[model samples]
Target chain A: MLTFKVKRRIIYLGIFCFTLFLCFFYVIKTLNQSLLYFKTPSEIFDDQNLDLSKEIRLGGMVKKNSIKVNKREIQFIITDLKKEILVSYKGTVPNLFLEEKGVIAEGKLKDKKFFIANRVLAKHDENYKPPSENQLDKK
Target chain B: MMRNLFSLNKIYIFSEKTLTFIKSVFPVLLILGLTFALVLSPPDYLQGDVVRIMYVHVPSAWIALGTFSTLTVLSIINFIFKIKILEIVNLCIAPIGLLFTCLAIITGSIWAEPTWGTWWAWDARLTSMIVLMFFYVMIIYSQKHIKPKNRSLMFTSIISIIGAINIPIIKYSVEWWNTLHQPASIKITGETSIHSSMLMPLMLMLLILLLYSALIFLMKYKTEIIKVKRSGVKRL
Candidate 1:
């Protein structure tokens, strides 16, 4: 048998943990929808009731050989491998914006197929490696 | 028996000895860490030398997260047991965690600009980190400004326990959301994506920061002990 004080402490701990669990449950229930920072092309296509007027973020890889550059605007296809959306932007892109690389475009949708982006950000993978000899020579 | 083993007098004496040892070792390790991070580590194939920021950025983030987790655990224990030493430990740790959290945010902004083309974003990971900083500020503010010592302790402990909810949210934010921040490269289990060459300097920097935190914690703990004694606290 445990002492009374130890038993009381255990009761306190149990109460504390249960309160924490309740808080976690409440946050998950209420904040789940707002917590998604961006939506992918596939998600946009799958959802028909998404608001079109509000500014939203579209994130995916820049599809290979889908880039079209003009003097003032640039256009490219953003894809999640299952679906694709055309993104048009007038602002300058980040240094990491390249074909077959991850990119996030922030703007509103023109339709189900095209997005008008006011900002573009490049997303790189976690892997870090030094430039190979030929790539270094190109620089 | 447990109380006697962790009595304030014993902790004070232990801190004095440890502080001297830490003071001697910190500068040497800091120099070695800087050399390895700046000169020895290879530049990234894509970002080049800008990748060096990870040495400072990643460790600060890790320390900030680790300190908050520790504070939350200790706060919970102190709340249940009313341990005086644990109170002092929490007091010393909150400020250090705040400093590192700020450092991580600033360094992350600097890293974000060149690579991501933006200095800030409302992404889940970044937003969650900002929320953590606010929680730290709230805890520190309550500790400093609240009246009636017992009431202050209760408030701080409650805030810390509530703030503990954000810790898991911050860690898993990148994975759970479509955020600009990439997922973790280093894992406790399974294979790590980061190369060994860069990993060495990162580990060294982590060691240096850990030592620095230890040094600060010991000093703060010693001062708190002295303050308690001067106030004629006979419980010790």
Candidate 2:
């Protein structure tokens, strides 16, 4: 027979384990239910059930040579390689927003082909490198 | 073996020696880390000098996550084995964890304005970090205001265990969801994308911060021990 202290310890351990399992279950369930922070251009195009009227964030790389500056308004095409959506915004873009750079635009989708963004955020990759000589010269 | 190693008398003696050692080494490390971080580290190709904020931001976030994980484990052991020392340790750690979490969030916000064009967003990563902060606050609050020492310990353990669930979510949030926050650059298992020049400074800063944390923990632990002794608490 186990001592009282050992028994109590075992009981506490059992309770901790049970609580941990419950927490894990809750986290998994919640994470599974629409926790997406942003939708890519391809995801928006493929999903027929996506509500276009509700404002959502569209994230992808800005297509090369697709940026057009018409006065204060900026137009660019965001592409996930498989699909692309035209994004139009009338404000200042972040310094990092450049051709082929990752970006997230928060707005309502006008249609499958166009997104009207109120805010455009530059999303950089994890990679970090020193500027090359030519790029440093340009700076 | 573990019990003997963690006994109050042994820990008290150990803390004294560790404190002296840390005090001496801390200044040297601080100078070295600052020089490497601010001067030696190369500017980023894209973000330029603004990327230097990462030296502080990443380390703070890492320590915040690490402290909470440590607290949760200690709380579990304390709850199961009824170790009084672990309770003291958990109590001291909670505030430090909260401070670092706040530091991480602030530094990240400062960094975000220049890079992401927004001060804040309800992204998965950012939201989960905020939740972690709330957990720390809850633990600290309960520890202070809860009546009956045993009940306080129980509440802290339970809250910490529940909060532990958020840890994994914070780490994987970038991958599991498309967040404005970038994915991890430094990985334990895989190849790191950060170049060695930047990586060196980052590591130096992390080491300095970790040393600072150790120094603070030892000082706090010593004070708690003294307080318990003065109160004539026989549990220790």
State the DockQ of every prediction.
Answer: 0.65, 0.67
Worst 10 residues of 2 chain B by lDDT: B75-84
Clashes within 3 Å, all models in order: 0, 0
Report the C-alpha lDDT of model 2 over B147-184, residue by residue, as the tens digit: 99888888888899888889998999898778899999
Off by over 4 Å in 2: A1-12, A15-33, A133-139, B1-4, B233-236
List, residue by residue over A1-56, the lDDT tens digit for candidate 2. Answer: 65688788878778867977887878677776467778988888779897888999
Compared with the true structure, what per-residue lDDT tens digits does model 1 show for residues A63-94? 99999999989999999999999999997899
Cand. 2 TM to true fold: 0.93
Model 1 Cα lDDT, one tens digit per residue, B6-28: 98878888888898998999889
TM-score of each prediction? 0.94, 0.93
